[model samples]
Target chain A: MSKFYSSVTKKIWMSFMGLFLMTFLVVHLSINLLLVFSPTTNLFNEASHFMGTNPFIQLFQWILFAGFVVHIILGLILQIENWVARPKGYRVKAISEESFFSKYMIHTGVIIFIFLAIHFVNFFLVAKGIIGEIPKTLVDGKSVDDMGALVIALFKMPYYVIGYLIALMILGFHLDHGFQSAFQSLGLNHPKYTPFVKGFGHFFAVIITVAFMSIPLIIYFIK
Target chain B: MDLKLKIWRQPSAHADGKFVDYQVHEISKDASFLEMLDILNEELVNKGEDPVAFDHDCREGICGMCSLFINGRPHGPDTAITTCQLHMRRFKDGETVTIEPWRAKPFPVIKDLMVDRSAFDEIIQAGGFVSIATGGVPDANAIPIRKQNADLAMDAAACIGCGACVAACKNASAMLFVSAKVSQFALLPQGKVEAKERVQMMVARMDELGFGNCTNTYACEAECPKEISVTNIARMNREFLVAKLS
Candidate 1:
């Protein structure tokens, strides 16, 4: 319970779980984006079928689910603890005089979490067979059926695309702080690698935001 | 050189604090900023008024006792070096300087330019140490620390535990201070035995003390008198992950 409740330890937990979730995002984006390059339904279906049936992937799915739960719950808990601990807040007026991202993490993280819920409802539910099957789409001038088509079709909705882009932007903001910060929490920073890590973190955030948002734009305009 | 001073004055930690304005005349351009303050204090004493209260000892800047936010930046307008080490030459003859104490909620103003930094002590007491013991100082070659690791450890150890990092931080985070300590110990073979517990305890204490989380704005490092790297924070996180899993 102490491990669960300790705010500092929770930060370690958050960083640990977040790194795993980051890997999951990479895997998820790779598999979902198969609609654009994979020229055949059987291949996409075969990939999805493999994902649905693989034992190692199934274990990873459970771990990923746990990661999401820990990330969200502990984030909220740590934030609440911070609020309760510093009810008086800083006496000086400084943030407006400094960086903007330092002050807006909570707002951006909350928005991202809201987007996460929507993502789960639309994609996770459909993938798990908890929700009704989404309608298929015509890809490369042929009627195709699979999870990849569902992703492409969902992005075709203008409102969904807008929401997704906003979510990705918020995620970018979160990563701007989180990427370097996680390493700091674990005490991994050093002079030789610190600048490189920060540069890489910013680059990672830009890449992820662009990659995630590009899918929706590609489906709506290019495809 | 003539200079304008806007220094914070509080009767006590319980008393309300406010900035009081004063003027200094015929100051040497080469004298350190604290010398200028000393000149003003002497004038005030000659005038039969109480001298201003500020923290300083070595005045060489390593003690970490001289914590001040000058003109919205910690340790004056300079990139590094504490207020004691800040030379007055940086400022123009007629420039107005604003001096204030560390403003974080965890660091309460004791009086004038000095704030209570016991929260840092508390964080250290919670974990920042190596519990292992040797009978006496062992041979230097016994623990062959790689040159890279030794340098990194020395760099982390360079942190003066000054609240300047906190003062400069927009979030008022002590991550730079905490991470430096964690990294300093974790990098050495002597400190590795307690690495797991040290990170866990130190971080818990940091959060427990009501300090805000690190947002990696680099403001702390930018304002640090020692220019402590934010990389220590990253190293601290990596150590914490290993601790959590194992």
Candidate 2:
């Protein structure tokens, strides 16, 4: 039973974790959009403060972090297994037909990982006051950390803005396949529903990407 | 019609192989792909040279014995047909066709274009069967199966165990093949008794034998001779999940 639960089974769990992270992205992207809607108010700051202080959010944070780590680690392991599956590459590999996004999953995944490291450094470290001082603002009657200020500051840097935009585009590409694929891996497939799922996957990919990209672009251009 | 052939030639599994170019002239277009190969082999034999070795049991395409990676596509450039059923008309006259074996770690080259597909047999042996008593033949109506399920099982059962799915896969993953075997049984009543152990053991053996993980590329379906759907893979996943959880 232990042997049965070891390697390939990780793929099933990774699918669940990958989808969970995708859900987290929807939430994360919505919150980031708060910056573009009203950067001047303490609404974004209040939301951030609540997220940092909320008991449930704090607990979910650990699970979310675990989801990211395991997804990444198992992805690398699967990639290695895939590589070992064919140690000798085909002499003539002319792909007549296959999805374009399906080819460079690891490439896009690596790009997303790099962007995530930089993203966490800019925002998460600042929130924790480990790298930069956290700015405080009063929202409604209570004092809160200026999360929007930190985000707007980062967007002001042209390179960070460009990098963020590119990263979101890559994220979109990753999700273009990842979304429907996770469903397939988890056995949510049917002839009737799969076309819808594929369409929904692409739609979600584009929307999330455009939404996240808008945040950085709006901040850079307006401020 | 005349055609140029660059066929992979390996004397033995341990020997280094290279492409040996040969030209055939005045071949009829209506000739089947295997028939064209037959003509080429005959010419080589007449010239006192070794004939190109390939696999074929039933030239009509049902046996799944023939496999040839022609011009970078499994079973030649045609879609949804085995190499045995492929016609030489698909190739233009004077075209150079490159033939290679099914190149995967689990499927080492036996010689020329033939690969050892026993790994597939091993996967089947792992859990692809149901134990039953014999001696007296049971009535055909003894076990009742749903029409829809019977059709799905028959669809999965259409897999001829050809390595084209693995050959066409970029990662050389046999998920389609393994899943087809698992789904064929998991769908039926007799096979459901051991469905848990079947999926678990087969998947374990698949991993142990060094097949790549399925990344939902769908190339297996695209190039499968039987045109097996990747949905069977999803079914296998569902079975695996249920087995592990329960």
lDDT (10s digit) by residue, model 1, range B1-246 = 999988889989889777789999999989998899899999999999878888888888788888777877888887778888888889998998888788777888888888889999998888888777845888879878899999989999998888988887765778889989998989998889899999889888887677876656678877888878877877776777788779
Compute the lDDT for candidate 2: 0.87
lDDT of 2 at B219: 89
Off by over 4 Å in 1: A1-8, A38-63, A80-104, A121-133, A136-160, A183-200, B1-5, B21-28, B42-50, B92-96, B123-150, B182-207, B234-246
Real contacts recovered, all predictions: 0.33, 0.67
Per-model CA lDDT versus the true structure: 0.78, 0.87
- Residue B43 lDDT, candidate 2, scale 0-100: 85
- Using DockQ as the measure, the top candidate is 2
**Model 1 chain B poorest 10 in a row by lDDT:** B208-217
- Give DockQ: model 2: 0.64
Candidate 1: interface RMSD equals 3.9
Interface residue Cα RMSD of candidate 2 after superposition: 2.0
* Residue B156 displacement (Å), model 1: 3.3
lDDT of 1 by residue, A1-223 (tens): 3334454466677777877777777787776567666664455655776787789988988888888888888777666654554444334444323445646777888898888888888877887788987554554565444776677677789998998888999898888777766766555666688788778878887888888778789788987
Q: What TM-score, to 2 decimals, does candidate 1 have?
A: 0.78
